[model samples]
Structures are given as C-alpha cells and as structure tokens.
Target chain A: MSEHNDTFFIGWSNDISAGLRRFLMRAAAFVVVGLCVVSALLALSITDPARSLFGANAAPDIPLDVTLRGVLSSEPYPFLLTVGDAARPAGHGVLLSGDGKHAAVIDRAALGGQVVEVKGLLLKRGALDMLVLSESPRVLQNIQPAAPAAPVPMGRWRVVGEICDGKCGAGIMSPGTGIAHKACASLCLIGGVPPVLVLTHPLEGRQFLMIADSQGRALDRGVLRFVGMRVAMEGEVERRGDVVLIKVDTGKLRRL
Target chain B: MSSYKAVTWNRNKLIYDAVAIAAVVLYIQVYRHFGAMAGRDGIAPDDATLSMKAFGSCAFVLLSGILSIGPLARLDRRFLPLLYNRRHLGVLTCTVAAGHVASVLSWYFAYSDLPPLRALLVADTSVAQLAGFAFVILGVGAFVILLVLAATSHDFWLAFLGPRVWKAIHMAVYGAYALVFGHIAFGALQDARSPALAIMCALSAATLVVLHLLAGRKGAVEDGQFAPTAATTPWVVACDIGEIREGRGFVVKLPDGEPVAIFRHEGRLSAVSNLCAHQNGPLGEGRLVDGCITCPWHGFQYRLEDGCSPPPFTERISTYRLMLDGGRVLLDPRPNPPGTRVSAVVIPQAHQTPVNETSAP
Candidate 1:
C-alpha cells in the first residue's frame, strides 16, 4: 500500500513540473514578442521622419520657367546656374555685358574652359516692340573659320551730301537753326553734308572701308553732323557720282 | 522569477548598437570635412560660411538616419530591437538639427543686416529663416516626447499607470516626425546639390507613404469596431477557445469600423483601442516589441498587460477582458472598475499535441 502511494506522488510531481515548463515557454514567447514591440517603438521614435513608415511624401512636380533680364555689364548675372552633373561652378552672362551700352554680358571668370551654351528669349524692360533672342551661344570653344591676311591696306576720307528728305540730320536742327553759313564751310571741308556723310581712304586701305557699311547700318536715323569738322577719316575710297563716296578705312580714321 | 529579467536581457545589444551608430556618424563627419577641403578654393571666400556648410552636411546625415529607421524596421524584423533606444536617437538627431540651425543664424547674423533673433525664427529674412523655425518646432516637439519617453522607460511607470493610458500620450511621436520631415525637405534638402542626397530624400519619403498605406489598409479591414460618435460605448471582446496564441496579437473589429488591438501575454490576451489615441494611428497593425505593442505610425509603446504607462510618464487607455468558446474569441466592451487586474487568455496550440482535439487546454 505504501509503495502504491509513493508511485502516485511521483506521477503528480512529474505532471506539475511539465506544467511549469510549458508556462515558462509561453512566458518566454510573450517576452520575445514584447521585446520586439519595444524595439520597434524605439526605432520609430528615433527615425520617424513623421510621414509614414516608408517616409513617403507629397512632392508633386512644380514648373520652373522664371527668367530675369538686366544690362550686360562687367557684373555677371546674380543668379547661379547649376552646371554639369556635378554642378561644377561656371560663369554666366552678366559680366560680359559691361562694355558701353550692351544689353547683356557673359562673365568669363567661372567659365572653367567648359563650353557654355546660352540660348533663349530674354524679355527687355518696358519695351514690347523688340525682343532679345540668342541662338545657342557657345563660349570658350575653339573652332577654325578662315586664314587671316598678313596686313590689309586701309585709308580715310570725308564726303558730303545734302539732307534732301526724311529724318536725316534731324538731330542737327534746333527749333529755327539751319546749318550756319560758317558751319557749312567747315563741314564741307571735312565731309559734312546736310543729310549724309561719307568716308574714304587711299586705295591701299581696304579693310577699313569694308567696315564702313557695318558702321553705316548702325546709323540709320542719326546724322553724322560732325562729318567734315576735322573728324578722323580712314578707309578705302569708293568714288560714285559727284558725291565722292569715300569708303573710309576704319584703321586710319582721324580728325584733320 | 522577476519580470525584470526579460526587460534587462537585451541591454548590452542596445548599448553596442548605439555605439556603432555614433562611430558611423563621426566617421561620416570626418570624411565630409575632407570633401569640403577639395572644394574649398572654388567655394565662396568666406571661411566661416564653408565651415557652416560642412557642419550642415553632418546634421543632414544624422537627420536622414533618424528618418530612415522607420522604413528600415519595416523592411526587416531584425531591426525590431531598435525601438527601445529610438528616443535617444531622437535627442541626438535633434541636437544635430539644432546645431545646423544655430550655425545658419550665426552666419546670417554676421553677414546680413537682420537681427539675430529675427533671423532665427522670422520668415521675413529669407526662405531659410522660415525653414529654420519649422525645424526648431519639430526639434522642440521631439525633445519633449523623448524626455518623457526616456524618463518613463522603466517598470515603475508600468506598475503605476497600468499600460493603457501611458501608451496614449507617447504616441505624439508621429506628429513630431511629420514636422521634422517637412523641415528637412524644405530647409536642408532643398539646397542639396548632390544626386545622392536627392535620391535618399525621395526614397525616405516614399517609404513613409508605403507604411502609411499598409497601416491604412489594416485600418480599413477593422473599420467595423469604433463608431464615429465621441461617446459611443467602448468595445469589448472575449477570447474564443483555441483562438489565442501565446505570442501573437490578433485584431478585433467593432461594429463601427474601429479595431481593438489585442495582445496575448502572460497566459491571457487583452485588448486596447486599436486606433492610436494620437492621430488615430492604427495600433492593431503595429508589432509587439519589448513587451510593448508599439504603434507603427509614431512608435508609442504599451506594456503587454494592464494597459498603463511604463514609468515617469502619465498616460492611459481603456482595457478589456477576454473569453473563449467554441474556437471563437469573445470580448466584453464594458469598462471594468479601476484597480482590478485580469490576465489575457492565451492558449498555446503547439502544446496541445493532439490531432483530433477541437479545444485548447
């Protein structure tokens, strides 16, 4: 009878120990899960970029077509244009315009020998009449065009003509002022005409005369009032009619 | 055995991880200074300005790491342990962010005509100023949350608030995250020249969106729980036989579309408001780590049993009892009077070992 009791006690003890082991395992699993949760929370607190778990955002595309315009002076454009894939620093078209009365200039300081191609329509201030446009302007590039002549011949002269029509020489006229008699004498000696002035040079000066047409195109409405007034005259001669069309050489023009 | 054993076991891992991160950050900062040296001549003539930029880069890197932790955690469960130390990371990130702002202020204060205080906070100075204010706000908010979390990251708070309420207050981390993200994007990321930085920002932002989407889907699935009314009766559910798992938390849907996040711990499964009390973040979708079911949206943590604040924190949420019958989980939505303790009902199925049995032991 005592042996039977001992066997029953051992069985009961074994069952209790098994139950305890099961309980511990279950508890360990919970603890593992709990650790996971706490770790996740800590990570979120540290790295939560505040949007979503994936850090997604509403970064919709926005259009950027802004343009600015200013005088081309020695100073370059104030805004910086990110250049190249690496954003290498490069100069822009502000400083290049510094000479005289130019509309724009390209600052060559930051050019870095990298080709800069500036192209686009730049709106002018308060003028709807004419627009400034540039085709792809490649800067800092070396491209051969043609060979140059050793030394070109050039000369200068003055020719005169009357202001027969239109707004020619209009700037020379005061309210009631005419070319004063003395003024006409001096202007006639140089190359001054009522409406036109022509430049000429000895046949040796050809290059200066070639630039005369370009200079003429620049002065459509403006009159060359001081043409015969001891003005510099240097260009090849192109005699035509009684006008003595002096195609002046640009290199040797001088007041005489 | 003391409950502290489980909590303290992973402390070394936490310290080691923290040290490794610090080393990486320091290395990055040193490497960045070298990069700055290469570009020094081409940059502006101001030495001070260049130094500030280098410092800002370090701050940018730190903030990026913090923002990336969330998506990283989601991608791999191995990172689940980072949650307990996230508050410390927050402090570090905010410090770096704040330092960047300070440098900007100093640079501007000396060079620009604007007053120092105004330069720091007012948008009138420049876009940079507006962004600075946003960063500061985000930093301050994060600091507050971190201070609270760090102070209360112990068992004492768990014993006091009983887990429910404590979990609710700590959930503010989500709001702080949103603010910081915007601050970075508009402030530092906007000025970034490197494609790598842009890519990082884009990826981080995308990760956040994906996580939100997944969590939202989970919310949709449990929308039947909480009603729209503010004073609607709280939800209750009882565990069904063979439904509780020893380690897994299950979802309980209410009639109204709200869900109850139920965790089976300590031989029982208890339910709490599935919607994160802060920002309605779906807690049911969150994972369990370190005995706390962390809200996936912001990272708020609640102990496994007796929903209460862990320690040094004062927050609470509603708790419910569970029962099981015929393999169906049942919950009682009615509130239990304060101070009464009840363990969750969890039955480990693997232990049953019987093929034909229809019930859990």
Candidate 2:
C-alpha cells in the first residue's frame, strides 16, 4: 500500500530521461517563444493601406470638368452619364444644387430614363464611376424614343460574387464586404449607393456590373437580404463599353 | 479562519500581468501599423478600422491562449504557475474584447440613421442568410459573458455565491468561446481570401481540442486507478500508517467514489473529505496549519476531528472514521454527516511502521 503511493511520483519522473526531458522542454519553450516573436513581427508588417484584399481593380479617380449628355436613372441609386452608344452605367453621381447640399431629391420616377446634360466632378472608382453634381442639369432635348435596341444577349452564366454597395465596394472602404461590414453595407445600399455585383471571376470583359432586375430596373429593397454574402446568381449579362450589366431574377439568387 | 486579511498584490503576478498586457498592446499596434502601410488598390486608408481589426484579432489570440492554459496545466505541473493568475489574463482579454466592440460600434454603426444599438441588433435579421445573425450580435454575446465572469472573479463573489455556483458561472467561458468562434467564422472569415487566417484559426481550435482530450483522458485514468480494491467491509486499507507524513494527508478513493483524506496530525489519525467546501480544491494536497486542515486553494480551514471551520467560519466538510490495524491505516467507506464530530484514531507505538517521515505541520 505504501509502495502504491510512491508510484504517482515515480511514474511522473520515470517516463523520460532527465537529460532528454530537459532538452524537450527547452525545445518546446524555444518553439513557443519563436512563434510569439514571429506572430508579433507578422502582425507589425502586414499592412492593408488600400484595403485591396481582392484585386488591383481600382481605377484612378480622374477629375473632369466636362459636361456630358446622358440619361439619369433613380432606381438602384442615382447615377448619371452612360458611356458608348447605348446607356451603359458609365458614372454614378448625385444631383447637387447651387447650395451644394444634395438637391433635396431628384424626381427619378418622372425624369428617369430621360436624356439630360449635367456637369459635376467625375469620381471614378474601379469600373464604377460617379459624378458629383456642380449644378442642376440643363434639360437637354429628350431624344425621340428610339426603338428599344434589341436586347443584346451576351450569355446566361452562373457566377459567384458578393453583393455590395458600389460606393464602398469600389474601394471607398477597405473590406467593404463581409459580416463585419454587413450592417454598414446594408446602410450604404439602402442609402442609395448603386448596388453592384462584384463577380469572383471575370466573365467576358466585365468583373463588376450594376445589379438590376430582369427588366434592367434598379433593385432597391429586394437585394437587402443578399448584401455582403457570396451568392451564385444565374443572370443575363449585357456588356456596353467597360461596364457589364447583370439582369438577375431575384428568386434565383442562391447563397454560396 | 485566520483573523488576518492581507492585500492580494503579489509582485510576480503584477509583473507577469503587465508584461502580458503590454505584449498584447504592442502586437496589435505593430500589426495595424504595418498592415496599413501595405496599401491595397482603390481602398482609402482608414486607420480606425484597421486598428479595430488589429485589436480584435489580438484579443482572439489572447483568448485562445488563455483557454489553452487549463489543459496545459493539467498535462504538466510546470504550467501550474500560469493557472494562479489566470483571472488577470481573463480580465485583460475582456478589456481587449471590449476595445474591439467599442471600435466596431464607433466605426461601423455610428453614422447609421438608427441608434447604434438598435442598428446593430436589427442590421440583418434575416435568419435565412448563410452568414448567420449579424456577427456583431455574436460578438456582443461573447463580450457580455466575459464581462460577467471578469466582474465576479474575486473571492468575495466566490464566498457569496458559493464554490459550486461560482464554478458554474465561470464555466460560461466555454459559452463565450463558442460565441467568439461563431463571430469569427461567419464575420471576418466569410469573404477572406487568405488561407493564413483560416489555418491559424484551425490550429487554435485543434490545439484546444487535442489538449483537452488528452488531459481529460489522463484525469479519467487517474481517477479510475486511484482506488486499489473494493472494500467488502466499511474499512478500506487506505495506505501504510508510515506512508502519511506528520500534519499531512494520504488521500484514498472510497468504493463509492468519494475521496477520503486520512491525515496524521499531532500523533493522531483523522479523516475528512478530500474535497474542500470552497472551490472543491483537493484538501489532501494541503497540510495542517496551527492544528487545523488548511485548503490549498483558498485557505478554508476545517478542524481535524469535526471537519468544521473554527468559529466565525461556518464552512463544513464531511468527516470519515479511520482505524489502524497493524501497519495499515483503514478509512471507513461511509462519511459521517458534514460537521459531525468523529474521534481521531491513534496509532500504537508497537504498530507504527519504521519509515522515514517529514513533518508538514
């Protein structure tokens, strides 16, 4: 019975040679200390100045004073001036009045799809572009309703991407997507930042596109549920110049 | 109870805590500073957000390390020193976690149309989403648990709540750990392209699981083997009378799974429950101080005969009957009701085994 009591202590010390035990202890201590030092160094060295974890897809914000004639759409957030022969999402801008405060509100329901010339600062972030209004647009002659161009079908494809507000997703904020930024992204999208579908892979010449319904109308509250999630969307893609517009069926959006 | 209450400050503990906290702060600052320097295309530099992420990550790491210590200490006695001041580590971890929560609230939800708290709660109520409820909510849940545990870490709360209640409450750290794990898994790691973060997270989780499993297995094995044989009668041969040192105890597991501490004090043999009333610390691991059994954990004392703390202290533990037959000391399997006075058994000089003994009084 007394000998059994000694087994506890004896079992603990007898498992390993003292020299080997000392060596292993020292080695473990060294590894642990080394890991700590390395972690510290890595933490100190890894900086995300631009928050560009995805890709170098940011386009330089070229300041422009040029006035342009284009159609203004109010639905998926206000943006002006379409590039190329067709109305492709060229640059998104806010309608600012003389006082510089956002012109209380632009009656997008009435004026949407109407061609007008406006002047403002051209802010470009990646493929998404925006114009800060310098003054109210001079109602340019509304082009006689041209026969709606035949829907140029690019191709129906499945792509996985995050649904984020164009303003922040286009490098306005570092890491503008993900659960941490989900609430903020929802606010931005709700606040009328053009909701853009950033594709995980470039299909055709477009990696980013203005997300709209099947009819190319702005999807406002319908997309709130999918914001900040990587979702697989089967949508028809239409390319006009550098912009690709994805016409998605809201019911078909699948969370990846 | 010893009518003395001294300040709890220990120089070694203070130094250790200072170094740990300083290291955490330094690591976070350095990581944020460096990460900000490496600019990504298009994204504007927001130092506030960067600092938030840095501190948040550091807090997570600290929490992982803190949780790992329990299993580590169980696996190796050398790690016991780490256990003594673990409350300080937990408090510091909570402080860092609070910093993370504060930064997120200020930067992410501050400018929202709704109040910050409301916005955080209602941000994304879509339970159907793959990302789960706003990860912020998970983080908040974890933070609240940590706050509660940290606030109640002192001995006053332990005494007020009692050891069982206090231990149950503190076990909520596991709940916090689960919440934080969800917070990270769905939040930061959602759209993360870097595998480094994923690997680190997996490693931290694996280390915790493996260490706990190993320690638990070892403990189960020890508990199983501690008892030599089932007693046909009430008296079980605990050990040789000589095996116990003066003023110290030889702990033996009864057939019914209760541990009995057979103590040799003032040339007499007495038995009490090995478990201390406060915190359930092993009383057998402690020694007699001024003729009363002192608990190794919180200095809770019980008289050798009655297993009751002296006057002004109402703590009581179950006492057991002990007897000496020849060279062997036998402990009665049945425990007398707690605080019951049981007479001590004396070993005759002729039956005392010849063995070298150290006095622990």
Candidate 3:
C-alpha cells in the first residue's frame, strides 16, 4: 500500500498521515487568514460613523437621569428652551419624547407660557438634542419664563436629506438614520416621536431641523412613510436659537 | 466507522471542531474591532449595531466557507479532511446566524409596540418596493432551513430517515443559500453606504458556481468514456484489468448515469455501488483499508465482497458482477440487491495483481 504513497482520510481514526496533518494545518491557516481579511473588509466597508446614545449613556439606558430648567414651547412640536450656563453659552431648544416611542406627554395649552424643570435621559449630538422624558415636567415656582430668541423666517427653500425620528437622531440609536433604520424610525414616528428633516448638505450651516406639518403637528402618513429614507422637500426654513425648524409642504416631499 | 448513533468524536474531529470554532471567533472579533477603526470621521457606530453586523458578517463567512468544502473535496483529495466532521461546521454556522437574529431582535425590533419576533416577520411589508422590501422574510426562510439541517445532522437521523430521504432533505441547503443571497442583496445591500456586501455576495456566488462547474465538468468527462458500450451489451467493458490500481476503485459509468466502483484487491476484482450509504458520498473516490472499502467522506467501511458495512455497522450498498474477458474487464450494468455477496474474479498469473502487497492492513 505504501508503494504509491496514496493518502486517504478516515474521520473515525486518528492515525492521520503526517503529511495530511501538515497539509491540514496549512489549509486551516489559509482559511482563517482569508476569513479574517474578508470579515474586516466587510465590517470596515459597511461602517457608518453616525453616533448614538444607546450605549454608555448615549441612549435609552435604564439608569440615566438628567434635569434641565427651561421654558416649554409647543409652537413647533414639543420643545424645552434651556438657559445655557458657562459650559454651554448658546441656549438650547431640546426636542422631547416620551418613555417609549411616544412624544413627551405634556398638555400643550397648559404649558405654553410656563417655566419648568424637565427631567429625562438626554440624547445629544451636534445641534440635535432630545430629552426622553421620565415623567411630566415640574413647573418651577420662582423661575420666570425668559423671552428666548424670536424665530427668523428664511423663506421657501428646497432641501434634501433623510427623514429621521428626533429622538433616535439625537443619539438614541447609532446610525439612527438610513434605510437600514427605516422600520424602527417608522415605528418611532408612528408612535409619536417627532420627525425631523436631516439635511444632506447643511442649509445655512444647519444639518437638522424639527420638521412638522403646516399646523406644527406630527407629519401625516404620506411623509412618515419616507422616514429613514433620503427625501427632497420644500419647506419654510426658520432659525430658532441654535436649532432649526421646518414647515414642510406635503405636496413637495419626494423620496430621493 | 461507528455503530452507535452519536457524534463520532475522534482526534481528527476534535482538531476540525477546534479550527472551526477558532475561525468563527477570529472573524467576529476582527469584524467588531475593525469595524470601528474602519469608520469615517473618527466616530464608530453604536455597540448594538456593531455587534449585529459582526455576528451577521461572521455567519456569512462561515456559511460561505461551509458551502465551498464539498466542491473543493471533489476537485482535490487534499481537501477531504475539511469534509470530515463538516456537520460541526454546519452547527456552528447556525449558531452564529442565531446570534445575528438575536442581536437584531434585541436592538432594532425592541422598544416597539410589536413583539420582536413578530416584528421581524412583519416589520417590512413593502414587498413590492425593490430597495427595502421584505428581505427579512428571506432571512427567516433561510434560518428555518438551517435549523432543520442542524437538527437532523445526527447519525441517528441518517439511520432513521435512510440515506436517500436524508440526502433529499439536506439538499435544501442550496435553497437556503439562495434565500440568504436574496436576503443580503435586498436587505443589507440597500442600506450599505459602500458596496462591500454586494462585492462579498458576488464573490461567494461566483466561487460556489465556478467550483461546482469545474467539478461537474470533471464528472462529465469521466462518465462519458464508458457510456458508448451500453447499447451493445449488458456486460460493458469498463476498462483493462491493469487500469485499476491495487486496493483502489475504478468507477464504471453506465448509460443511465449510475456508477459502479470496481475495486482491485487480493489479485482479484470486486464491484460495489459508487455511492456511499452515508451522505451519498462518492465511494469510488475511496480506497481499500483492512480488507474493506472505506468511504472517503466519513470512513464508513463496507466489505468489497458483499457491500455490507462490517458487522457492527448496519449499512449496505449494491454490489455488481465483474468479468475478466482476457485482459479486458467487463461489468454488469444492473445492480444486485444490496449486501448480496458476489465472488471476486481472480486475475490469471499473467495479470497477477502485484504480489498482493495491499493484503497487509
């Protein structure tokens, strides 16, 4: 049998030929190296750098609590007007969402002119800020409602970018926008998370805006279906403090 | 090689499983760590998302690797070692795929009104939308098939269901593979900012298709050689007696596409079905060891005389009658009842089979 030096494999027997063992070792090494290279390439190439707050305090962490004292506004979706301290000079308008996918639970008429302290977990990124409300805000007795900056209407403008839920965009979900995040974003929007227009190219140096209908309410089904997808739309662009707001024309919203 | 129904663990199996596990770990680790480094603007994606991609990519790599082994073994005998204990590799792949499903359910499908699994099934109802249609359904289909394959991978199931039925069931791996390809093409590929998933999917499909084509070409060439004699007589001349090596088989392809393995052992020739009873492996590719034909795929041994696996192993394959008409070796096209003994045909001294050196174990 040794005359031809024929090598065959037997799975039940451990008496493998020395040559086969060496060959297998080499094969294994080659396979492992190939797999690692492919894996790294796949992981590297598909990477999206968008940040999220889900991990390490950026997201819906169970044990995170933040308090902000601000004037509650309901003109363009529910927002908290915070007085920035020394660390944050430019005062902020924070978007708010409820515990789950719902928007922050607040009576719009009662809180329109009230100064209050809002408590929630913050999802912050760039100019995007969202407070996932722990409960109803505490209306402060002593704090006076400060007159924040007036909205500067920037006329009719055409814009392009993805439509994402405000909460996820601020930091709740990393890579919180895109077709991959579409279903979740749709659920969020349907469940009352405020929708926003994340611009493809920053218009007037702003990448995001709290987007709503002409009535300043959540977008209807026609626009919400485009969530997590890039869309081009015409909206009334207005600058409010460090943040931006847009009143989108439903007829002009087209998926990009 | 085993009588009982359990994983037939051996040194080779241990080594094979260890290498498979290491490969999976290395792939996932490399993906998770390098995915961050590969990100743009010095920012990494969320941990949940990164982990999901890591497991997802690792499962793809493993499934691709697993599918490649069969054609590779067919093309080159050196790769047969990979074929040994391949079920473990299959089980590992399913486990990794399960991890991917879990990650998606926990992170993306969670915190919603619908239950995670139900949401996974019903999340994307846009079946007509090409870009982001119901790709999850394809993934679910593939996962179910993988689950079935993994569940029935035991030898007991093989024995219980019998080889033909088991093989027919396992053939659904290709269907699962098709579903997986569609799942990636429509699902992940749509949102991937880069074409990595597309490129990877293309390469995997190309490799499997090209390798199978090459192996099929080889099979066609061999099967074509002996088919012309089928119309003339039932006793087709397979080859010259000397064409078969000592202690090895020369496959004779009948016109109907069935092959019979004719082995030269102890200065005589014996014939058995070319298909192994286990996994329908190519028995003609195997060689004789200790007076029995050992299937190269999993080492299921059957005596050449009766085509019966030795006493403890209750498996059998059909045997055939061989005739030495002078120097020409002719074979009967019809297969005898499995495990029926047929006496080996002795070669005359002029064609004496090399002093019986192969008789020694």
Q: Total clashes, candidate 2?
A: 13
lDDT of 2 at A212: 85
Interface RMSD of 1: 28.9
- Among the numbered candidates, top lDDT falls to 3
Instruction: Report lDDT (CA) for all predictions.
Output: 0.38, 0.66, 0.78
How many pairs collide in each candidate, listed in order? Answer: 128, 13, 4
TM-score of chain A of 2: 0.62
Residue B309 of model 2, lDDT score: 95
> What are the per-candidate TM-scores when only chain A is compared?
0.19, 0.62, 0.79
For model 3, residues B1-361, the per-residue Cα lDDT tens digits are 3534566567888888888889888988998888777355445677788888888777777888888898898788889989888889989999999998898888878887788887776656666666456677888899999999999998878877878999899889889888888887766776776777888899999999999899888867543355346334778888888777787788878778788888888788999998998878878778788888988898888998999999877788999988877888888888999999999999898987553446532
**Candidate 1 lDDT for residue A106:** 39
Listed per candidate, the RMSD to the true structure in angstroms reads: 23.5, 7.0, 4.3
Name the best candidate (by DockQ). 3
Question: Top TM-score: which candidate number?
Answer: 3
In the range A12-85, model 2's lDDT, one tens digit per residue, is 11233455445445634653564456355544333332233244554345445657666665544455545334
Q: Where does the lowest 10-residue lDDT sum fall in candidate 2 chain A? A: A4-13
Q: Interface root mean square deviation for model 2, in Å? A: 8.0
